[model samples]
Target: MHTRRSLLLTAAAGSSIALLGLATPNATALAATSDQGLVDEARITVQDFTGDTQFTDMRRKLARAKGVFIVPQLLKASFIIGGEGGSGVLLAKTQTGWSEPAIYTMGAGSIGLQIGGEASEVMLLLMSDKAVEAILRNEFKLGADASVAAGPVGAGIEAATTTNLGADILSYSKVKGLAAGISIEGAVISARHSRNAAYYGKQAHPRAILYENAVSNRGTLELRQALAAAEMP
Candidate 1:
C-alpha cells in the first residue's frame, strides 16, 4: 500500500510540473499559457462535446448541471507508472447566466504497468450544489470530497443514464476525438490562485469568482455563451 501511494504521489507531482511548463530543463514551450488561451480552448472543447452525437447523454446532464468544469487537454502518458494532468476552468450557473470562469488544475496518477500516451478532453458536470461547494475550497478530491460517476457513452448510454444520478458530479471524457470511459476517482483538483490573479488582474477567492460575482472578463463571453447554448433545451 505504501509503495502504491508513493507511485501515485510521484506521478501526480510529475504531472503538475509538466502542466506548469517545466517538463524539461531546456524545453522552449510552456505548458501554461495566457488565460485567454485556456478560455478559448475551453470554448472550443464545449462546442466539440455538445455538438458530438456521441455525447447525447452528456447534453442531457448539462441541461440540468449546477456547474461545469472544462479541461481541454488532459495529457496522460506513462511508461509503467501513469499520470494525467491539465488546467481548466469552472463556471457556475447564475440567475442571469453562467458565471465567469475560475482557474483550476486537475491531476491523477495510477499504479500499474502501462505504455501509452493520450491527450483527452474532459468535462465534469457538477450535479449538486454540494459538489460545487467542495470544489470551491482550496483542494478537492474525487470519490472523497464528492461522489463522482462516469457519464454514460456508446450503446449503453440510454440505460446508464438512469444510474449515477445521485452522484454529486458526472464526468465525461473524449480521447482521440471519440468518447471514451475514463477513471478519475482518485484525482486531485486544486485552485490555481496565481493564474486566477493573472487572469482577473487581482487575487480573488474562488467563491467570489464563481459565486459572489466579484470579477468578470470580456474574454470569457464566448465560452459562457457556448455553455449557455448547451444548457438550453
Candidate 2:
C-alpha cells in the first residue's frame, strides 16, 4: 500500500508540472527582468480586467481602492494533496499616488483525491483601512484574518452589490477571457523578502515600499502607467 501511494503521488506531481508548462509558455521570459517580470505581468492583468465590460464595477472600485494586489498568473495544480501557489505584486493608492509595488506569494493546500492543474489571474482589492492593516502583517489567511467578498460586476449589479458588500477584501478572477468574483478563503498570503531584496538592491519592507517610497523604483514606471490607464472616465 505504501509503495502504491508513493507512485500515485509522484504521478500527480508530474501532471501538475506539465500543466504549468503548457499554461506558462513564457516561463523562460518570466525572469527576463528578474523581479521586474512580475510587475510587467501584473500591468497586463490589470488591463485585461478593467478592459472587460463585465468588470465595469471593478474599474469603478479601483478609483476608491486603498490598495490592489495583482497576481498575473496563478498557476494551480492538484492531486490528492492539492496545492496552489504564485508570486504577485501589491500597489497601494495614497494621497501621493499609487505606491510602488511590493512582492508577495500566496499559497494554499487541500488534501483529497484530485488531479490536473490550471492557470488564472487573480486580483485582490483592499477596500478598507482594516483590510490594509491585516495584510501588512507577516502573514494572514483569507476569510480568517479578514473578511472577503467577490466583487460585484456590471453597472446595475454593482450598485446593489456594493451596498451590501461589507467585506474588507474583494476578490476577482479571470480565466479564458471570462472574469468573475472568486473566493480565496483558505489561501495563505505572505511577503516575499528575497524577491524584494533582490529587486531593490536592499532589504525593503512591505510597509515602506507600499506607503513611503512607491516611486523609488524606475522599473515600475510602466506598472504605474498601467494602473493609471485602467482608471475609468
Q: Rate the local accuracy (lDDT) of all candidates.
A: 0.82, 0.74
What is the alpha-carbon lDDT of model 1 when measured against the actual structure? 0.82
- List runs of model 2 lying over 4 Å from the truth: 1-32, 154-156
Give the TM-score of each candidate: 0.85, 0.81
Give the per-residue lDDT of model 1 (tens digit) for 41-120. Answer: 78888988888888888888898989999988787999889999888899999888899999899999887888988878
lDDT of 1 at 198: 60
Clashes of 2: 1
Top TM-score prediction, candidate number: 1
Give the poorly placed runs of model 1, Cα more than 4 Å off.
1-33
Query: In candidate 2, how many Å is residue 70 off?
Result: 0.4
lDDT per residue (tens digit) for residues 1-233 in model 2: 22432343345334434444342434322322445656766777888888789888777777878888898767667877877777788888888778889888888877778688766789888888887777788897888988888887665774577553687888889766577444478888899765576567667789988887733668888888888778665
Clashing pairs in 2: 100-214
